[model samples]
Target: MESEIGAFVAVATVLTITPGLDTTLVLRAAASQGTRNAYATVFGISVGVLCWGLAAAVGASAILAASPTAYTVLCVAGAAYLIWLGIGMLRRARNRGRIAQTSGTARMGSTSAAESALRSWSRGFFSNLLNPRFGLFYMAMLPQFIPDDAPHFLMGLLLALIHNAIDVIWFSLLILGVRLMGHWLNKPVVQRGLDSIAGGVVIIFGVKLIIPVIFS
Candidate 1:
């Protein structure tokens, strides 16, 4: 069991550090909105992860894996959501750029902290939940770590908690790093650049997700 946990941690750590949608979203939020919003995003993503883990433990994810229709529906929804988010970012960047040119200063539109946090959290949650890959991943990868004698549901939850812990630690460090550079990051030029880059990357991912389904 100890070995199993060690092995799970090793693999989960690699996955946690990998640059992906979650990482991109968190970085963008931290740099643009501040650490509080970023933390909210992380919390939402963690909840999504736990839900997937629970689903996988109870064999619900297998249904997603097994049914083409179900998978395709989720794939489409997730892709659309990502694309919408990316386009929104791109629009904001354009607006900011225009404002900067006209007034010699750029400001990304601001929202109430509560509003921003809620939006960020919802985006994070739905983005994670609607991602079929998460379901597939938990279904496929988690069982490998379960001991023969262990309760599958409990073990899965445990593994999920471990994964979440790793994610929190890594993202906290990332948020801190971003905070340290807040001065420069808050600059209009830098903010616009990051928005454009993050938006483009997210759209690319969304397109990638949809293309496979469309062609298949």
Candidate 2:
């Protein structure tokens, strides 16, 4: 059991640190609204991961994986959503100059900071939730950490918590780093560059999700 937990932690750590939508969203939130918003995005993303992990524990992962049509449908939806987000980011980059100044107001805007935080949180949640593979990732990767005959409920919950803990830690670091670069992130040229890069990466992922892999 101990060995399995350790292995799971290592695997989760590697995956958590890998660049993905969650990381992108956290960085975007932090860049746009500072550390507080970044934390909110990270929390929301953690919630999504937890939800999927719990669902995987209950065998929903198999159900989704078993149905190619369902998986395809989810892939299309998620891909479309990502593309939309990319477009939005690009638009923000194009019109950043029009936005109100953030001289020293903690990046507040027309609405309260709390509202922006909630929006960031939702972005993280949906970004993860929409990926059908995420449930399967938990279903597949997490079981490697459990004894074949072990009771899955408590064990699953524990693994889920560990995964989320990794998430929080990595994203916290992202927020901190972005906070340190707060000045650079909000600059017009830097913002445009980020928008272009993030947009391209997201669009590529979206395409990857939808494209069928051919085997000889």
Candidate 3:
């Protein structure tokens, strides 16, 4: 059991470190929004993982894996959301000059603290929640780690916790790395560049998710 748990953690850590939607979101936040918002995004993503973990542990996420209709619906919805989000970022990049001029005063005044946090948090949360992959991944992966002799529910939850822990740590490090390069990363030009890259990547992910459904 101990060895299996260790193996699970090792695998989870590798997956957590791999670049994905979560990484792109956090990178954009850290580069453009500031430290507070970046951390908020990380927290939201962690919460999202926890929700999926719980669902998987209890076998609720089987709906996503077992039902093609449900999976298709979620895939389309998630793809739409990602494309929308990416478009917004690309627009910001396009309007970077005007945005830089008004960003300090107008931007802060237009968006309240609470609204900013909520937006950032939701970006992270929904980015994971809507994408049914998390549920499917958890469903397929957790069972493999749990011992037949152990309680399935308890073991699954434990593995999920380990996965989430790795996520928090890995994302925090990413945020900190961005901060360490803040001087250059915070520049309007640099921010726009990051936004463009992140936005394109996000859109590609969205397109990839929906392409199979379209062809099928």
Candidate 4:
């Protein structure tokens, strides 16, 4: 059991550090919106992760994995959502000047800030939730760590919690790192550049996800 846990931790750590959509979203939020917004995004992602874990524990993820129709539907939906989000970010980068001008208006600025916070949370939540790959990962990989003597659901939840803890710790470091670079990241040009890069990466992943479905 101890050895199993150690292996799981080792693998999870590697996964947590690997650059992916989640990392991009969190870093972009920290750089552009501030730590509070980034943390909100983190919370949303945590919730999504928890949901996936629960689904896997209850064998719901098995159904998803087993059903090609269900899996394809989820994959397509996730891909479309990601592409839309990427395009929106690109559009924002393009209109940064106009947005900056609008921010000077007090009433609109406050409303925009509130909306932005909610948007960040929702974006993080849905981005993680909609990705069928996450469900597949939990379904295919998490069970290997469960000891046969232990209750499957409980063990699964515990493992999920461990994964979430790792995520929070890693993301906290990322947020701090981004905050440290606030001086440079705060510059409009730098912010736009980050947005462009993140948007492009997300769009690429979205396209990659859909290509199999498109051709198959």
Best by lDDT: 1
lDDT for each residue of candidate 3 in 1-216, tens digit (9 for 90 to 100): 999899899988988888999999988888887777787888888888878887887889999978999999999999999999999989988888675343342123444766887799999988889989878988888878888888877887788778888988898899889879877775777777888998999999899889988999
For model 2, how does the per-residue alpha-carbon lDDT over 146-179 read when each residue is reduced to its tens digit?
7888888778888989999999998888888887
Candidate 1 residue-pair clash tally: 0
Question: lDDT score of model 4?
Answer: 0.84
Model 4 clash pairs?
none
Clashing pairs in 1: none
Give candidate 4's TM-score: 0.92
For model 3, what is the alpha-carbon lDDT of residue 105?
Answer: 23
Winner of 1 and 4 under lDDT: 1
**lDDT at residue 143 of model 3 (Cα atoms):** 79
Better of 2 and 4 by TM-score: 4
Cα error of candidate 2 at position 6, Å: 0.7
TM-score of each: 0.93, 0.90, 0.91, 0.92
User: Which lDDT tens digits does candidate 1 get at residues 1-216?
Assistant: 999999999999999899999999999989887887899999999999999989988899998878999999999999999999999999978877676342212222454678878888987898899899888998999999999899999999999999999999999999999989877787788888988999998899899889989999
RMSD values, in order shown? 2.7, 2.4, 2.3, 2.6
Model 4 lDDT, residue 61, Cα: 91
Which of 1 and 2 is ahead in lDDT?
Answer: 1
Residue 40 of model 4 has an lDDT of 82
User: Which segments of candidate 4 are over 4 A away from where they belong?
Assistant: 101-112
Considering summed lDDT, which 10 consecutive residues are worst modelled in model 1?
100-109
Error of 2 at 70 (Å): 1.3
Ordered from best to worst TM-score, the candidate numbers read 1, 4, 3, 2
